[model samples]
Target: MRKILVVEDEDAIREVVALNLRLAGYEVTEAASAEQALAVFSPSAGFDVAVLDIMLPGMNGFSLCETIRRDSASIGIIMLSAKTLETDKIKGLSIGADDYMTKPFSVSELLARVEALVRRVGRQGASSAAPEPDGRMVSGVFVLDQKSRVLYKNGTPIDLTQVEFQIMELFFANPGVALVREKILEGVWGENYFGDVKIVDVNIRRLRMKIEDEPSAPKHILTVWGYGYRWNA
Candidate 1:
């Protein structure tokens, strides 16, 4: 069974989510605050995913997400928030979250999102263990090592969140192809994602900050006006 850490301040929300996750066959660990969650979390805990609420009693979700990410690169993170603003969503993704869900969300949809993230983590773990036939993809000064899930620019490592890495992989896989916003959402976030397509836009901006010498004048990942984005190289 996949282990999941759920951190929510509200007792009711925590109980409901934990109960449902257990029903769905996940080994659920619940915490009422970030401190409590951190107390029990360790590399050996073997958690596959973390579900964090943005509004917490202390040490807000974003900070907690960063802490968890600092501990484990392969574990998936999903942020829950009552905020509907695009900036808030972007902030969550910008930090390290693989996925974000606004409050008043359907439990079914949340479950699906969790499952998708778990599957993605599993796939990446497997890929890391297996050697790729085509080991590396090079575009301009950027190099993506598919087997290790690492990106390099000018032979130097570039830090990228899991979500950003996946987006980059998609662009590298289909160079010169214009990938629509919806296509990016489906590819990176999953087909069951019910969030805004703007998530793609946010991630694209983040990618530019890392890959482009000047984010305002991105040469590699270009906008296609009405269509979407295309990888020039």
Candidate 2:
């Protein structure tokens, strides 16, 4: 069974989510606060996913997400927020979350999203081998190492969030392909995702900042004028 860490300050919500996750066959670990969650979390514990609420006492969810990300790059993170603003979701993705969901969300949808995230993580864990003979893809000055899940710009490593890494991997895997917004959404955020497409645009901008010397005029991962984005390299 896949292990899941659920951190929510609201007792009712935490219990409900944990019960449902347990019913769905996940080994659920619950924490009422970020401090408690960290106490239970160890690098060797092997948690497959983390479900964190944005409005937590003491340490906020974004900070906790970043902390966990620093320890494990491969674990899936889903940020839960009561705010519906696009900026809030973008902030979650910008940190390290692989997916985001707002409050008043359906239990069925939550379960489906969790399952999807687990499956995606599983695929990444299974395919850690080099995608190319050299285990890296060189396009222009950017080099992407599949095994390390790291991007290099002229031999210098560029830090990327989990979502950013997945987006880069997709672009490298299908060079010269014009991926539409919906396609990119399904590719990075999983098919069960029902959030705003603007999230994709937000991430694209973030990716450009890291990979493009001039983010204002990106050469790779170009915008295709109302259609979508295409990877030039």
Candidate 3:
């Protein structure tokens, strides 16, 4: 059975979210704040997903999300924020969230995202070894291990979120393909994904920050003006 951690301070909101998730057949653990969330968190606890509210008592959700992401790359993270600012959403994604939702969001949509993220995270942990010939692919200074779902630059491992790794997989597979944003969205987030297309750009920016020496003038992931992005190996 899949397990979920829902962290929200408001009693009504937390109860509603938890009840809905439970009705959907997911075993959920509830936490009122960041501290409570941490107390319930265990690296060995095998939590498949965490829903964090951006505003929380003491440690904020951003801080908690970072800590959880840093600890386990395979665990799926979704951030909840009432703030509708683009920057806030970007900040959540930049820090490590796989998805972000605004308040009054559809319960159905959140459940769908959680399900999609579970599949993604499952893919990363599907295999343990890569003895296959095509399991490892090299693109310029970076080597992406498909089996391990990890990227290394000059032999040093680079941390990647589940979505980021999938994006890298697509990019490395087609080094100079000049894939359009829609293609990227389909490849990474699937055809039925319910979200804005600009998420591709946000993730691409995050990748540049990690893999490129200068993110402002990226040497690898190049923009194609009005088209999309092409991986420059």
Candidate 4:
């Protein structure tokens, strides 16, 4: 069974989320505060996913999510927020949120997202090699190792969130090819997404920070003005 950690301040929403997740066959763990949530989370705790509320009594979900990312990128995180603004979603993605959902969302959609996140993580875990075009891809001194799901810069390992890894892999697959916003959305995330696409920009920018030698003037991943992003081989 997949273990899920739910951190929400509201009692009712937290209970509902936990109940629904349990019904879906997930082992659910709940936390009302960010501190408590972190206190409970460990690298070997065996949690497959984390469903976090953006708002909390202390430290907030964004910080909590970042902390978790710093520890492990293998685990999935879905940020839940009542704030529906594009900036809010961007912020969540910038800090390593794998998926974003606004408040008052359908339970079905939420469940689907949770399942998708889990499945995506599972695929990454199962793949002994990078799932990209023509074996593995490399640029400069950086190498994207498919089998291990690791990025090495100058022979040193680089830590990347799951979303960042996917973006990098996408770029590696289509080097120098301009990928449109819709294509990226459909590729990285599944279909039927009605949320803001600006989150893609946010995530791409964040991904650049890690993979690019200079984020200000990116060399590998370049934004194609009005088109989209291109990976320069």
* Structural similarity to truth (TM-score) of each candidate: 0.89, 0.88, 0.92, 0.89
User: Residue by residue across 159-222, what tens digits does model 3's lDDT show?
Assistant: 8888888888888767788999999888777787787788888889889999998999998999
lDDT per residue, candidate 4, 41-109, as tens digits?
998998889999998997989999899988888888999999988788878888888889988888888
For candidate 1, lDDT tens digit of each residue in 1-233?
A: 99999999989888999999999999999999899999999878999999999999889999999898887867889999999998888899887787899888888888998998887777652322233467777777888887677899989998676677778888877889999999988887778776778778888988898888899999999999998999986
User: lDDT tens digits, residues 113-215, model 2?
Assistant: 8888888777652332246686787777888876787899889998776678778877876789899999888887777776678878888988998888799
Q: Best-fitting candidate, measured by lDDT?
A: 3
Model 1 segments more than 4 A misplaced: 125-134
Candidate lDDT scores, in order, read: 0.85, 0.85, 0.87, 0.82
Best by TM-score: 3
lDDT for predicted candidate 1 compared with the true structure: 0.85
Superposition TM-score, candidate 2 onto the true structure: 0.88
Off by over 4 Å in 2: 125-130
Query: Candidate 4: where are CA atoms >4 Å away?
Result: 125-136, 192-194
| Number of colliding residue pairs in each model | 0, 0, 0, 5
Backbone clashes counted, model 2: 0
The candidate with the higher lDDT, 3 or 4, is 3
Q: After superposition, how far is residue 3 of candidate 3 from its true place, in Å?
A: 1.3
